[model samples]
Target: MSTTKIGWIGLGTMGIPMSQQLISAGYPVTVYNRSKDKEATLKKQGADTAATPAALFQQTDVMIIMVTDDNAINEIFTGKEGLLSAGVNGKIIINMSTVSPSISKEMAALCKEQGNRYLDAPVSGSVKQAETAQLVIMAGGDAAIFEQVKPVLDKMSKMATHVGDVGAGNVAKLAINTLLSIHTQGLAEAVLLAKQNGIEAATLMELLNNGALASPYMKIKGDAILADNYKAAFSLKNIAKDLRLSKDIGLSTPIGEAALKTFGAAEHEFGNDDLIAVKKYLDK
Candidate 1:
């Protein structure tokens, strides 16, 4: 059995719950969140909290990063007194945050120079999935190191795919989210149009459920739209962030540029509410 302890950084909305799944599985986990109050739940689940990212660096065999964006990810691995300072020899760093693929490669290079390993294992699911270990994980890294982390990953995901090397996982995540954004936005739009065109939304939803358009995601979220409930299963702000990252990836392609403009408008219109509220923007 691998006796490696885990060091987790950025225990925010998604991180806290995911770290708990590890602790609940009886793994020795040390966590650091810039904010201390967020550590409460992880602590209850048997995680030892560190006040600063640097303070927790040398404590584990694998360090998992789950912060918000690329900048935060870079700072943790290369910042003043960051992981590089603590030394990463024989250790692995698994980044589960949604970051730009280019940044993932940069970190991979840095880790190689220092004899550490890097895995970009971004997830697709919300806070609720993190709590239940039902998230889908897309990973990119050396296959050997991925095998090493697979045991722990099982505690966090219902499905974990090792996509390829270095930045492939990030690319896969972006693709998945892009398709999800396109589909969800379409579903939300169709529901709105159906209702406004003198159609009973629930009946339309039932037909959708029984017909070629049926998907549990469509049915459930579509119902939320009809009921006008925009609860934040995944916040609009975060999805906007992903869409923005996707836009950055697609910058050289004209079609992608247009899609970026469209999603950006939705983000601007929806602001910080639930992602399902994207329907509001598609409405007009």
Candidate 2:
């Protein structure tokens, strides 16, 4: 294997495709996932599998984590003979999970103390973007460290920008996701309004798609709403989680608080389904 071989832990919807890109790029990628069935495709695509995260880490110079949330990141880092056991000296851990800033700071401090470098790079793109390596990457960490890992990150993202210190990436991601909450929730509400007034949801969405109000994301969300297919492009459960986390930033901001409640209502109405169903709550 090349010394530049990459180790990837996590092979879900986005992670699988993203890792495939690296493997096809000639970076020997060793993947570790709790469920082995999902990775059959990756194996066929010229990737190897490790029995454990530590074993995977042992094979690569850089480790990329693309889990669901902070808890998962923690479990992976602190898993039996995990990242810490691998001893990250001369290695960099690029955390691509969308997690809380406090958690990022904690991870950063831990990595620094152990002579490992950490980068908080929360991505802003869906599965499609991950497959195409067209993701917009917002990264925060040391400039020197970023440059060291730039080539690898470049393989996964179309545009990678360093935001600030280690935890700042999450801060920027939080702000961006905040606007997304507003747009997603607001679009849901508008669709609900049309439905309640006896307008065809599909027809209205078609008009919106061709009108000035259309956004690509909105069209996606609208189609899901029309089909009642909330299959987790982004989970509503996570939307509620993000709003709940954002609420802690500033409760006095009534707008954000309203959004928090709005998404909360969506969670209640949709039963922790696909997040795009936030529109159904508005309809109810």
Candidate 3:
């Protein structure tokens, strides 16, 4: 077993599998989640459980956070019984959540003040990739610190690239998510247009999959669209949140602006569903 003591926060869809990768890789891992029941699966895998974020930090040298939104991120780091509450030092905090760059920078500075290291290391790809240890991690932090954690990160990702200094990963993630929104919206519009003009959904998807626009994402999401399986691998509400976060970070181009409006509107009814559920919203 590896000697690095790791602490994980959050056990959401992506978090559960990603943290499992580390445990399976033989790292000694301890987990903490607000919903205590989520810790059971990890515990069964021989992982330890901590009562709180501060307790988890105290037990481990590295802390990995993968939670929902900026609010949850704030709560994990600063709320009562949070990691910061312990007055720890020489620890590293890796935030793999999709949050604003500003918050990441703030957290990085706060960690520095306490003599701890921080990395904004958000990921691309969804639950499927995470489950299979094929996630692409975009990290921003000190190069040396990134190198130190690369092996641990490798357990969960197919690739982990150090993009820049603190908060750069969040910027890169938001940029990628913005384009993802645009691509998904474009795909939905194309399929809807084809359906309206008397062409079958399968036919257009086949052409798109085989033609110049072909991609793994197109194939996976295309299959989901054809099957009408909008079951939140990556939810509609999250993309809408990413778009809003993008706008706050200065994304105002025409296509991005339109996709923001489109996804924002779709979030009202299909927020909990898969993002491709936008196809249904547009069809209505």
**Residue-level lDDT tens digits of model 3 in 145-202:** 9999999889999999999999899999999999999999999999989988999989
Kindly indicate the candidate among 1 and 3 with the higher lDDT: 3
Which stretches in model 3 have alpha-carbon errors above 4 Å?
A: none
lDDT of each: 0.82, 0.81, 0.94
Off by over 4 Å in 1: 251-259
Model 3 scores worst on lDDT over the 10 consecutive residues at 33-42
Looking at model 2, the pairs that clash are 236-275
Which candidate tops TM-score?
A: 3
lDDT at residue 106 of model 1 (Cα atoms): 95
Over 196-224, each residue of candidate 2 has an lDDT whose tens digit, in order, gives: 89898888999999999889888888888
* Candidate 3 TM-score, C-alpha based: 0.99
Clashes of 2: 1
